[model samples]
Target: MTTQPPHASGANGAAIDLQHVTIAYHRRVVCDDISLSVAAGSFTVLVGANGCGKSTLLKAVAGTVPVAAGTVTVEGRPRRAWGRRELARRVGLLPQSNVAPEGILVRDLVARGRHPYRSALQRWSRADDSAVDEALAATGLTAVADEAVDRLSGGQRQRAWLAMLLAQRSEIMLLDEPTTYLDIAHQHELLELLGRLHAEGRTIVAVLHDLNQAARYASDVLVVAGGRVVAAGRPAEVLTAQVVEEAFGVRCRVGTDPVSGTPVFFTESVPGAGG
Candidate 1:
C-alpha cells in the first residue's frame, strides 16, 4: 500500500512542481503518480534505496527524461512550453559522472556552460568570459583555470563541474549522487560548497545515498520507496527511526547530531527492521 505523502510546498513559491507525474524506462514504470514541489531556494535532498527512481525523478525535472503521464511545471510554466536553450538557462543538471574531453583545460570546460546563450552566428563575448571567470573564482578553480580537467583532484574535478553549472547561472540545480567518489573530507568540502550555494538563494535538489549526510545538509528530505515518495518534510520530522526502517529495511536508532543538531542514526542489524 502506498501512503500518499503530502504535497511539498516552498515558502517562497515552487521552483519545480510535479503533478501526478509517472516516469518509465523502456516501457517499465519507475515512479508512479507522484505529486511533489521543490520550493525556490530550498535545499531538498532525495534519499532512497538503490533503484528507487530518485535519479530518474531528477532527470524528469531537468527535461532529460520524458514522463509517461502527467506534467512537470518549472518556474510556474509547463516544462514543454520552454525552448531547449531557455530551459537550459533556467535548470542545470550534473549527473553521476562527467568525463572531460582529453586534455581540455578547466577554463575551456567551464566555458561550455555559456552554450545556451550562443547562436549559429554569435561569437564569444566579454559577458561569456566574465561568467566563466566568475564561476572559476567562485569555485576556487581560478588558480587551476589553465590546468587540464583530468589533472585535478577528485574534489577539484567535482568543483569544476559545479563551476560549469554556476556559469550557466541556473536558478535550479539538480545533482545526482554528487558525492559518489569523494572521500570523507572531500565529501564535507563539496557538501559545504552546496550549503553556500543554497545560502546564496539558489534552489538545490540532489540524490544522495547517505541519509545522515542528507539529514545534516538538507532543508527538506524526501524518502522514496517502491517507486513512490513515502515521506516528505524537514529532516527532524521525516527521517525518524521508523521511517528509516521502512524505507531501507535497516534496524536503527535515531539520534541528534551534537554539532549540527540534525537527526542521526545508528544501525543495529543487517536484516529486517521491526515495522
Candidate 2:
C-alpha cells in the first residue's frame, strides 16, 4: 500500500559529511572523534538510549550546535562556508520544541519558511506564495491552512510545523524526536507521511526512540551509544538482539514484523527483577 520514494542509498553521494567531529553541550563534550555521512535521498534515523547524544549529532549537522572540532561538509563545501540564509535554504531543522506564535494562522506560520528566501528590505513574491501552497498540499494541511496553528490537534499541529519546513524547500531535513508527544496512531500517521516525502527524494535525518518504528521507516539506521554511533546499516543488519542489548541495555527478542517485514524488538524479563 506504500509507494516507494525515489531513493537509493548513496546514489547521489554524501549530502552531509562529518569528519572527526566533536559535539559538546555547555562546553562539555558529548560525542567526539566521530565520522559519518548522510546519503542523498535516504531516510536516516538515529536510535539509541536516552542521553546518548543523538539529538546533539543531528543538531551538529544542522549547524545549530557548535562543532567543537573537525568539519561538517554540506554538499561539497564546508558547513561554515555557507551564509546563514544560504544554509537555511539547503537544510532545515525541526527541533523537538514546537511552539507557534499565539493565534497565528497555519498559512502565516508556514509562510515564515520563506523568510530565508527574502531579506528584510524585500517583499514576498509569487514564488513564495507558490512554495507555501506546495508545502500545505504536501502535508495535507490545505484544508486547515487558514486555521490558527494552536487551534489544531496535536497531529495537525505537527504537520503544520512540517509544512513550514517543506516551504523552506530544503533538500535535507533534520528532525529531533519528531514523534515525542504524539499518541501511537498519530505517530504512525506522521511517520507514514515522512515516508511519502522521502519517496519524493528528500534526505531525512531524525532522532527516534522506537526501534521498531525506526526500522519500519528508516532507510539507514545509526545505533548510538557511549557517545558515538555504534552501528550503522540497514535495520535488519544493525538492529540485532545483541546490538539492541548493548546500545539500549535491554535483553530482547528481535523478529521481523509480519506485515512490514522489518525488524521488531520485544523486551525480556530482567534478571532478578520479579520477586
lDDT of 2 by residue, 121-182 (tens): 99889989988998898778899999999889988888888889988888888998888767
Give the range where candidate 1 is weakest over 10 consecutive residues by summed lDDT.
1-10
- Candidate 1 local Cα displacement, residue 76, angstroms: 1.0
Local accuracy of candidate 1 as per-residue lDDT tens digits, 1-275: 11112323334389898889999989899999998888887899999999988999999988999999999998888899989999998889998888989999999999989998999899999989988998898788999999999999988899899889888877788999998777998889889988887887778999999988999999999999988999998999999988898899888998889999998889889684365
lDDT of 2 at 255: 86
lDDT of 2 at 239: 93
**Model 1: CA > 4 A from native:** 1-12, 272-275
